[model samples]
Target: MMKNIILITLLAGFGFNLNAQPLAPDFTVTDSDGVEHQLYQDYLNQGKTVVIDLFFTYCPPCIALAPTLEDFYESWGGGTGDVEFIGLSIMNDDFNSDCAQFKIDHDVSYPMVGIDGGAIPAVQPYYSGDWGPFEGVPTFVVIHPDGTVDFDPSNGVYDGPGVTGLLEEAIRETGARKPYHLTGTVTMPGGNAIGSFDLNIEGELYSPGQMLPGGLFELDILLRPDSTYEISAVKSGSYNEGLTTFDMIKIRKHVLGIDNFQEPWKYLAADANSSGGISTADLIQLTKLVLAVSDNLPNNDPWGFIKTDYLFASPANPYEEAYQGDARTYMF
Candidate 1:
């Protein structure tokens, strides 16, 4: 065990305890990218081993060790592997942008959180002796999937390559499993790519929906293996994009049976109240939305997702005979 140690170089005049906390305390912090990560829910509960590197923006040893940490992060599949790495700012006033810039300067690819991103409070328990003894900057902590903390996991080896090796060995000792990935492109019926949209992911672990930017959806989010997820894509705002008086006429006709919708999705789209059926009420709601009397439809989103593979029981009239269907469920 002594040979496997990576002694960390402190910021000078500071010391660390040889003993680590038996159980890791939990925390939630947002990263520079505005992504929220929770310790127990997002990683450990999902069976991942997490390595936390705590440092201030200008710490000398932290700066020098950045690149090696980046290499270590990539070795674990850049957050897609069983191991996840995060850099946290120990300073109380470092902004999210500061952490972002620090990562750019240090060429670190892993997630970095700063004071504005909730790093201060997140790290307080560790260094304040609430969790255990922690005495300095540029400290490395490895938390196993079992929620056990391994402080000074690198055995105080401050050198880059050696520290990386020790951290890897420590992670391997935890027996973490590779993460599952939730990834795919979101597009409209006409194959129009959506640049940004909200994602509601629910499964063994529930993450509040976040509007994932263009790159992340396809790049994939790590998920718990063998767990099921119900995903929904929602795009809102621009409440009256294609609505007009002429469309209102079409709805009126469909309601009166003078002319009916040809496609099942048309009924889903035309049902402005989400009442499961088309009627004069839908036409009135459409009229209000189109005329700018109201900015939204009653009980309905500006847009709703139907599974790409969903097949309506009644193709011509989706609402025929109290239809109960899978149109509202999505999986990736």
Candidate 2:
């Protein structure tokens, strides 16, 4: 057993990570849904930067990295077909079933599976160095279009700019785009922030981003010159009350990020300004409401968006008119 162990250790030294020279160790793994994915043929072959998340189910940091990785995936020229992402569970035990359950429970939209059933396990020991000191769960490594790997950010791997900064770095490094900067905000009607939610800059406008905590977003992409593009906000979260003094103060607090709000009001809703952001202006609008200087606050909404189901309701339906009797025209 000792001799066998020594031999394996010696063999691993001659493996994939022996100074990053070998072409990105190719592998084929099937997702729990039985969909086959190739590390090179499917991604690097199609001119897309391949990003793989090496993770495990039991790791907390790994779990925390899931959403951020998703956001990064979507923001980096996502819908424009510039990038692809996959998750590989590095669990060295029987975790195929756990991998499937982890995906469902976490609402993971990306492909995920354990390493043992695929070619990935072959290279794991080398890259992971026995899954020791350098084993970073949810380790995000990128494979460039030229069939090169971006394991170390410091090595000029990726350099694209804007949302998903690291990914843009990669895009820039690959010379994939000239890059146009698009920055904006997505807030509730009352000026209350949407917190964090996805925005799809479609018509292939390049990125699909989620709002920053301040309800702001920025996207830099290589769009067709003189061409128009469409942007859509992935309507998420609940619709709560956006009116009342409480709502106005909540908007103020949101803009301020004042967690220690004196009087500690319970918030149901806040964005009164329909500007897709919350700020002092929303507070002013609410002040107008309090003073009766204006009966209508711009947007008349403080919680969330009026989704298409309610926005594009039938005009011929009498109930539709009644439903919108108090609600103003849908805020964009």
Model 1 local distance difference test score: 0.68
Question: Poorest 10 consecutive residues of model 1 by lDDT?
Answer: 1-10
lDDT of 1 by residue, 1-332 (tens): 00000111101110323355457878999999999999999999998889898888888888998887887687567887788888889887788898899988989888899988888887776776644457676778888898887777665578898888777667766775433444544554445544555556663332323324432343235544334556655555566776678777777788889998786667777877777788788777777777789887657777656555566777776653223554655544
lDDT of 2 by residue, 1-332 (tens): 00000000000000113244445777888777678887778877777767666667877766665565566556554425556667777667635677788877776667777754562573374374332234455455666777666563423212223224655465556545333565655544334454554444453223336656545566655643334444444443222323356655555666678742221112112334444344577577667766667666445322222322332233323233322341212221
Residue 44 of model 2, lDDT score: 78
Clashes of 2: 19
Question: In lDDT terms, how accurate is model 2?
Answer: 0.50
Q: Which portions of model 1 miss their true places by more than 4 Å?
A: 1-143, 146-185, 203-217, 317-325
lDDT (Cα atoms) of all candidates against the true structure: 0.68, 0.50
- Runs in model 2 deviating more than 4 A are 1-20, 77-80, 119-133, 152-164, 176-332
User: What TM-score fits each model?
Assistant: 0.47, 0.42
